[model samples]
Target: MLIDSGSPGAPATIGISLTINGEVRELQVAPWTTLLDLLREDLDLTGTKKGCDHGQCGACTVLVNGTRINSCLALAVMKDGAEIVTVEGLAKHAGQDGAMHPLQAAFVERDAFQCGYCTPGQLCSAAGMIAEGHATSREEIREAMSGNICRCGAYTNIVDAIEDVMHAGAAR
Candidate 1:
């Protein structure tokens, strides 16, 4: 006798084990599922915004072993045993209790978002960009973050927030 798995017309589920936000997680998911879907749907880590799932937009950016990558373009099965860090993970890692990351605080102080739809992605990208030491100047920051489109046109404020963190050496 064969037991039916709940997925109608779908193949068998694959088990994936990964470390996310400093926690070990095990899930049975489809092989083709993207990391973004797993994080949001399964892990409840919705902080990793999904703007353009095609990787054209950096909104779905997340840190993989400290390197920023578009989660939407990555397969969850491919990240087995890898460390995944989303915006929520970053916040937790940067704080002790309920405090926010320096960049998050700077963004708030500078009002870096308008509709705030892109704020999560912007903050995540900014955090990774700053950590990578890729933004040496305002121009570089702007260039590095160009992949993240802010439809609200909060570019100036975004730069200000990132710069504030950079100048304060808080990106470390």
Candidate 2:
């Protein structure tokens, strides 16, 4: 159900469908609109931040098709029909439903964040890394998460949270 927002070229707009946070969103966006801009500005999914917008800071990291990527470097049009999960989607199911994801709970238990600005990206990156399942040690986790920068210097706690989740998954 992609709605034709407008035509391409001159004032060209393209219609794209993205499954964001388990919801299908059909939107009309410009070709040059980066995924970061599209999420924050158009879709109003601001959980993916815009730090260092050049794909360096990884603040705009999100899960696209089950892989972690920097949204700031991706064009919205390029991700048509992709399944995207932002930080907002991480804990959608909560309370009695046992909604909070393990990573989220671990962050709270480990005191994984300081300024909290980088928490979203950090969470998303950890989720993706855990899914990838290549990192098992603290050093590997840090290396995998190097793209996301936390200026408040909460690296140790972040690693602890991620490691807890990984080991828990192994036990399961």
Candidate 3:
């Protein structure tokens, strides 16, 4: 478990602990603070971008016990002892020497983003989506990633990038 300092506008300040990536961290946070807030503001893990504070956007997506979930919609207090994996975590696990994840590389190769604001969430969602066997086709990938809005309108490139990873995984 991990906890960090609370934000100024955060709710009730309290101590929090959670398993992030593979490390346990404890921090002082507000009771009403969201997981995204804690990760970005407290833990200094800004890889998970905040496109929308509401669940409507998947920009703040992360893996909770290997399942993809919106961090913005989850409260820090509710994630005690939960295994959380953020974009940074994914990159680390993809290689020991800081090599990029296959999905990340594919995204770069495919030019899957424009402003790159949504790239982190898209990559995280794609990683979990592919692992969960939720992406079977271009249509399926589109449907699964519908929650993540790419304001840059790079949907086609995003789908192509995800497909590249899926095919590569299948070949392996």
For each of the candidates, the C-alpha root-mean-square deviation to the true structure, in angstroms, is 3.2, 3.7, 3.6
Structural similarity to truth (TM-score) of each candidate = 0.90, 0.89, 0.87
Q: Model 1 residue 8 lDDT?
A: 71
Best by TM-score: 1
lDDT of 3 by residue, 18-90 (tens): 7898888877666677999889987899999888799887999998887889999999878877888898888
lDDT (C-alpha) at residue 40 in model 1: 86
Q: Model 2 reaches what TM-score against the true structure?
A: 0.89
| Candidate 1 vs 3: which has more lDDT | 1
Cα lDDT of model 2 by residue, 42-125, tens digit:
778888898998989888899899899999999989999999989888765222144677888898999998878888898888
Poorly placed runs, candidate 2 (over 4 Å): 1-11, 93-98, 170-172
RMSD of 1: 3.2
Q: Quote the positional error of residue 148 for candidate 2 in Å.
A: 1.0
Clashing pairs in 2: 93-99, 94-99
Worst 10 residues of 1 by lDDT: 1-10
lDDT (C-alpha) at residue 11 in model 3 = 51
What is the Cα-based TM-score of model 1?
0.90
- Better-scoring candidate (TM-score), 1 or 3: 1
